[model samples]
Target: MSKIGQAISEIQTLENISREDRWVNRLHPLGKLVLTVFYITVTVSFPKYELAGLAGMLLYPLAVFTVADLSFGDALRRLRVVLPLVMIMGILNPFFDREILLTIGRVPISGGVISMLTLMVKAVLTVLAGYLLIATTPMDEICRAMRVIHIPKIFVIVVLLIYRYVTVFLSEARRITQAYELRAPKQRGVHYKVWGSLLGQMLLRSMDRANDIYESMQLRGFDGNFRLGKKAALRPADFLWPVLWALVILALRLFPVVELIGRIFV
Candidate 1:
């Protein structure tokens, strides 16, 4: 209904994907992390011009999103926030190389266009994979996974602090936005210039809140780093599922029967 309500709902949907309950959620966060990394590695390893390979790479993350009860639509919508930047970075490719690579009817397509298309696909797929990973795995588990993988303590501490504070800042942002809408009834366009002032105020408030949180943590005897109580243990199912998926990914990548057939027929 309300903008604030919608934002909260979207965030909740993105953050929680364990709707099925038991088994999948119980898998070690490290396992999920490893699988995600594997997917990205294989996807990007293909030649940039291999459209078939790039398209095929979508299967893994899509299937995972479906089975894990993740929100594909919501993730795509969130991705729109950064798509403009991606497009800007890619725009120059077409201009730099006008050499004809292919033709449809009378119009010719250049290598630049093909490369740009590949870049866009890779960017979107990788980003969506990352979002799906976090959506299915909680932040606490991710930090614990990083530690288990022997990531440095300082990096883990920074990640944990960011995770904790980002939400605090988001809440503050939502409150300020709501307050602005209420105070300025039906205002539009140039009137929103006041956001600059509001932004500065919010920054000051955020700094104060961060200081208070630091003091609170110190009082609780928080050492320089966090230690998760116990690492998540792997179960038979956890080990089996990821391995099976990895095998499937590898088969499709190496074999690519569908692409072979397409090239032969077309």
Candidate 2:
């Protein structure tokens, strides 16, 4: 799947993004993790048709994107892989609920339409917020932060392995897909007949590769313990950053700043 390749490349981009020397990259990973949870919680709590309120959620991610000196284009490029799925998820809303709700200027909008837009915005904001954390904060830092917070070792380990190895899984899948495409060049796509055998082969190949990888790790003394760097020192910003994000989120949630600006201009 092209989506698989996109995910693999996305992780590579995240690793590169984490190396940028920026204020966001310097913030304590624990702080970012807490704020990320807060953000998603508040974002999801919004009513299904509250699109204006959801617009405000964008500010936090945009601010982080700027402060981290991250590439918005690269982020959106990866996000494209997700947009179609969200669209499909919400596509039935319009057909199912056709109640007339509000007007944008002279144009009437239906409840279902509003809800669809809300879902899309919510999807984008939540995904971007999570990616912001991933891009700026290294995987090891997140595991260390989880352990610091008394999170279960098994939970942390599972999360760490999933993040680290999903890319490997996708990489294997991509290689298999490429091989299939080359072999079946006369066909538009992999033939339906080959799908099952293709997947089985991919599984066998991936397992063998994974075993080799594990053995290599054992040779290098992986020891099941993910080595984390010295705990990042807490600075004043560590305390201030989460507070600022919370305040901004609350302000945007409680009041439609966008509507207020519209009124001032009107």
For model 2, what is the alpha-carbon lDDT of residue 22? 76
Which candidate comes out best when scored by TM-score? 2
The residue pairs found clashing in candidate 1 are none
TM-scores of the models, in the order given? 0.77, 0.80
lDDT of 2 by residue, 1-266 (tens): 37677677767878878867877877888899999999999998999989988887899999888766777777676667788999998999999999989877999889999999999988888888888888988888888889889888778888987887887778877888788778778776778888889888878887897799889989999877766667656899998999998999988888878789878988
RMSD, every candidate, angstroms? 3.8, 3.3
**After TM-score superposition, what is the CA distance of residue 56 in candidate 2 from its true location, in Å?**
2.1
Candidate 1 lDDT (Cα, whole model)? Answer: 0.77
- What lDDT would each prediction earn against the true structure? 0.77, 0.84
Model number with the top lDDT? 2
Candidate 2 structure, TM-score to reference: 0.80
